[model samples]
Target: MKTTERVEQAFKRIKELLTLVTDWTKQPKEEDALTKEFREKKLQLIEDLYKQLGELNDRFMFTHESEFKTKEYVVQYDALKKKIHDLEK
Candidate 1:
């Protein structure tokens, strides 16, 4: 290939790479904490809260409808679990 053609091909590759990365970061999605430690801590806290709430129910035999509703928010932590990400930056 001519020198001009080689340079043009290189520029094309660079442009493609820039486009790929640019589009990827354009939109941000709601995600749990980026760090493993934080996610683990949050997960742990959720488990602890669940266990304590269970113990409280066992001791007091909860009957109120609102008391049952309190556990609904704990489901939010299911998606907040520490996912073992395989992708490298």
Candidate 2:
């Protein structure tokens, strides 16, 4: 895959992990038998996504920080994150 594609995938995975966490948050009120398992799985996914995000950040650092130094990058990143957050709800 291309570098941009890989970055997008990492973002997508992080979004998925965030969604799982959000779901877990809403489960505290319920006394369901599956709650513990759900929490565990969400936590694991969050951890894995964190590691992947770190790697992606490292790659971004090594490769073109210059490309992301502009206002456009800020705008795009914020917009992407907002989309992710919206998905979580």
Candidate 3:
């Protein structure tokens, strides 16, 4: 698959995971007891996302330098980073 396609897929997955995070946060009080397991799973998902993000960054930096494409991936990477940070907290 093309780099652009790969990046787009990563973005979609990140957005989905973010939605999961939001839903997890909105769970009722009774689910509070499962928060630890829920968080661990989310954190693991973020780690996997980071792997893809890192590959995209490396491709942009080392293979080809296209401002338009790099900007696109960078924006998604930044957004995913922010989500991961929020979940970490």
Candidates' RMSD to native: 10.6, 23.9, 23.3
Best by TM-score: 3
Give the TM-score of each candidate: 0.36, 0.38, 0.46
What lDDT score goes with residue 56 in model 1? 51
lDDT of 3 at 87: 64
lDDT of 3 by residue, 43-67 (tens): 8988977887787677777765555
lDDT order of candidates, top first: 3, 2, 1
Worst 10 residues of 2 by lDDT: 80-89
Off by over 4 Å in 1: 28-89
lDDT of 3 at 56: 68
Overall local distance difference test of candidate 1: 0.60
RMSD of 2: 23.9
lDDT of 2 at 59: 55
C-alpha RMSD (angstroms) for model 1 = 10.6
Off by over 4 Å in 2: 1-33, 64-89
Superposition error at 50 for model 1 (Å):
5.7
